[model samples]
Target: MGLVTIEKAHVASELLVLKSKLESEGVICYLRNEYTTQIMNYLPSFEVELQVSELDLEKVREIMTRKDAE
Candidate 1:
C-alpha cells in the first residue's frame, strides 16, 4: 500500500530525523544501511536506504528532495 526510498547516503542522526518526521505524519518507515563488503580491500562511503509505505512515497520524497535542504 505504501512505498520506500533510498533517500540519500546519510549518517545515523539525519536518517533518524527523517524517519521521525515520516512517522509523525502517519507514515511507516524502515531504515537500511549497507553492510561492509571487501574483497582483498576495504572501501568507504557506505550506502543507506530509507524506506516508506507506497502510499506515503510522495510525501516522503517531498520531504527528502527539498532543494533548500540539499
Candidate 2:
C-alpha cells in the first residue's frame, strides 16, 4: 500500500520524536517536508508530516492517541 500522512506538526524536533516512537513500536514511518519545514519555519504550508504505510494507519492512530493521553 502507499504511504499516508497521519500527523502534522509545526516543529521538526517534535515530529522527529514522534517518528522515533512509531519506529520503536515497529511501525515504519517517514517524515515529509521535515527539512523544508525547518528551513521555512515561518511558513505554515511547510509543516512537518508523519507518514506511514496505508496498512498501518489504524495502528499509528492508536499509538498517537495513547501518546496524546500522556
Candidate 3:
C-alpha cells in the first residue's frame, strides 16, 4: 500500500506522541525526515512528516479532527 503524509510536525517528540496515538488505534505510521529535520532544525523548512497508508488517510484525518476538538 502507498503511504500518504497525514501531518507535519516541527519536532520529533510531537510526531512520536502522534505515532503512538495512531498505532494504538491500529493505524501503522511512518515518519519521514524525522532525523533529518532534527539535525537540520536550524532550517525553517524542515519538518517531520507523519505518514500512514493511503487507505488510512480518511481514518487518520477523522481521528485528528476529533483530537483537535478536544
Best by lDDT: 3
List of clashing residue pairs for candidate 3: none
- Is 1 or 2 the stronger prediction by lDDT? 2
Q: After the best TM-score superposition of candidate 3, give how far the Cα of residue 52 lies from its true spot, in angstroms.
A: 0.4
All predictions: root-mean-square deviation over Cα?
Answer: 4.7, 1.7, 1.5
Best TM-score goes to which candidate? 3
How do the residues 5-39 of candidate 3 rate in per-residue lDDT, one tens digit apiece? 98798887887877898899999999999889878
What is the C-alpha lDDT profile of model 1 across 1-70, one tens digit per residue? Answer: 6456757554545667767877887878776663332221244566566787787777767776773387
- C-alpha displacement of 68 in model 1, angstroms? 6.1
Task: State residue 53's C-alpha deviation in candidate 3, in Å.
Answer: 0.6
How far residue 48's Cα lies from its native spot in candidate 3, in Å, is 0.4
Compared with the true structure, what per-residue lDDT tens digits does model 2 show for residues 1-70?
8999887888868777889999999999888887887788888777888899999988988998999999
Better of 1 and 2 by TM-score: 2
Off by over 4 Å in 3: none
Q: Quote the positional error of residue 61 for candidate 1 in Å.
A: 4.2
Candidate numbers, best TM-score first, in rank order:
3, 2, 1
User: Which stretch of 10 consecutive residues in model 3 shows the poorest summed lDDT?
Assistant: 9-18
Location of the lowest summed lDDT over 10 successive residues in candidate 2: 9-18
Q: Which ten residues in a row have the lowest lDDT in candidate 1?
A: 34-43
Model 1 off-target regions past 4 Å?
Answer: 34-42, 61-70
Question: What global local distance difference test value does model 1 have?
Answer: 0.63
